[model samples]
Target: MKIVDVICTPGLTGFYFDDQRAIKKGAGHDGFTYTGDTVTEGFTQVRQKGESISVMFILEDGQVSHGDCAAVQYSGAGGRDPLFLAQDFIPVIEKEIAPKLIGREITSFKAMAEEFDKMTVNGNRLHTAIRYGISQAILDAVAKTQKLTMAEVIRNEYNPGAELLPVAVFAQSGDDRYDNVDKMIIKEADVLPHALINHVEDKLGAKGEKLLEYVKWLRDRIIKLRVREDYAPIFHIDVYGTIGAAFDVNIKAMADYIQTLAEAANPFHLRIEGPMDVEDRQKQMEAMRDLRAELDGRGLSVELVADEWCNTVQDVKFFTDNKAGHMVQIKTPDLGGVNNIADAIMYCKANGMGAYCGGTCNETNRSAEVTTNIGIACGAKQVLAKPGMGVDEGMMIVKNEMNRVLALAGRRK
Candidate 1:
């Protein structure tokens, strides 16, 4: 069946996700302050709820399938305002995207996404948040027509006969306060059985020594309280450019910080993210490649991950091909199009770079579920459990999808 009309429903609000499970540097997310060093800095997100849009496709046969839009709270091409994005995206959908999709056949999900990407190239710089909604809606329509799970469709189209495996899960868990940290350690170790990775990625402000000290405390606490004595989960940290900012292009200084963190996290490896930030994708790749080489040369086991500037497939590929970073996050919301995220993961796998499928905390349960399935289907290293404050919600959605897909695969076999 051909497409009929595409409709967007706005005013769906989502809670901003927690920042690395750690106490944020500035004003805390949702206005909850963990460290009360009152400086009207506002580095953390205060608004937990923001309006979003849900795009629905009404086929000529009157069948409907929908998709939710997830936008970052503080960062995006349009500057983190979902309401503004929803408002600005309406015309792009109606005037540009919808017309192109109106009479198009919906046989290939991959082809549709690629065609849409081409159509949106050049002057059509519509943000990925908008593209995410339309592409998801169309994919939902395709899945409905084919009678298969979202992950199944990807397997059939991209890697036929590829085996489906359970996606290894990671939960955000870093609270500056001892009590919060205590709670997270217990939950991550005891409560969540498959959480092989305990993550903490956030803005740490500008104190290098203080950052180093705190991470030491964190590593010790987690190792001490961990459930499996033999199994030490990966300690992943995303600083969001604070490390590079503190050193100010001093590679030696950055090396000192990395070495300090490496020493503290010794025996248990560390995955550090956003060690530097550059606006230009090329410059960002250069910085990442430099750091990666530095770490390798210094015999540091720290794995560098690129997040900020590598928001699209081509950018991610550049980072991979150049060996700029050990791994790159597919960054689901920023990249949109579930198929693109899947393709990016495959690209990383083929290129020998690590792949992690991730999304903003600004997503919903529905969007989170979609991401979970896509990441699991594509066999990503890990999928960021999202669309909520605590990890349980994202974890629950991800686990449920795994069970569902497992059942589907069993039936098909």
Candidate 2:
């Protein structure tokens, strides 16, 4: 199929973007908005509405294959691309990108995705959001051209020997961690409650007592509310490095505290992500490696997940090769092209590192659906329910997409 035309539309994401730097610096929450000066650049407030651009490609057969260009919730922090605003980038796509995409042949997804993913304007590569969305459209176009599901295209091109199956779905509970846990339990999410424990003093507590209490409560609640006695969901919490702040980045202390959490979780598995953020990639990797070693040496079964500094496919390999964490969250938007997501997940599985196909709540339904296909195609350990922190909507989108892909692929056999 050949690209006949290109279209771009400005849109809203499912959630708002928060300045992570400002939030960490003690920005108080007022209702859903933050009450403080914005720390990161390209922000009118500490929190603002998220924006997206839908890139649609018109093929010769008149099929419209589209993808949503969206950024992470904590944009511009942790070595990511600067803030993505539709007003600023829509024109860039029309002027710089649309021309190149107009006459391209939809021959190979991997070849075309990598070409545009590395394309640059004004001496810098295109923003990750743009590359992410454009690559999705490319994949969809190729799938439509080949009369196959997106998952099938990825499997055929990337991992022909892989089986198309459903991946475990991990859901996030934004600030409504308490009520949302009920929703997650009711739905029986495979990975329950990514309790957003960003603040040390409030969420994690000055000495980590608050999070411990929360984990205990979570364990009890799951046991009480589950419909089946055997329904055991993994407890995966993202602390955003609050544990490190509370314990002064002491590896021994952090490991000890995690042991307490694991005990609190009792029969359930526990995976803690971003336990400490040293703010530099090298330092962050070393901390993760040391912490993982400490946990293993003590025979602790708790799993450590690498986030923050582990943003790209290269970062995933770096952390995986060093055994920095048991699992690495392949944050979809940060990796630019969807091709990298496929490669990262395969690499992690090959290296015996858990690959969590995760993306931001600050995304669109299209992006979530696309990533779900990629996760299933690559055989990732877990796929995140995304586009919103509210458990139900995100779960429905991800879970339904997985089922639909699996059903369609099954028919082919």
Off by over 4 Å in 2: none
User: Model 2 lDDT vs. the true structure?
Assistant: 0.94
Per-candidate local distance difference test: 0.69, 0.94
Alpha-carbon runs more than 4 Å astray in model 1: 1-5, 11-13, 16-48, 58-63, 75-88, 91-104, 120-123, 173-184, 187-207
lDDT of 1 by residue, 27-61 (tens): 44343534433322332333334546787888778
Tens digit of per-residue lDDT, candidate 2, span 237-338: 999999999999999999999999999899899999999999899999999999999999988769999997899999999999999999999999999999
Total clashing pairs for each candidate: 2, 0
Indicate the worst ten consecutive residues by lDDT in candidate 2.
157-166
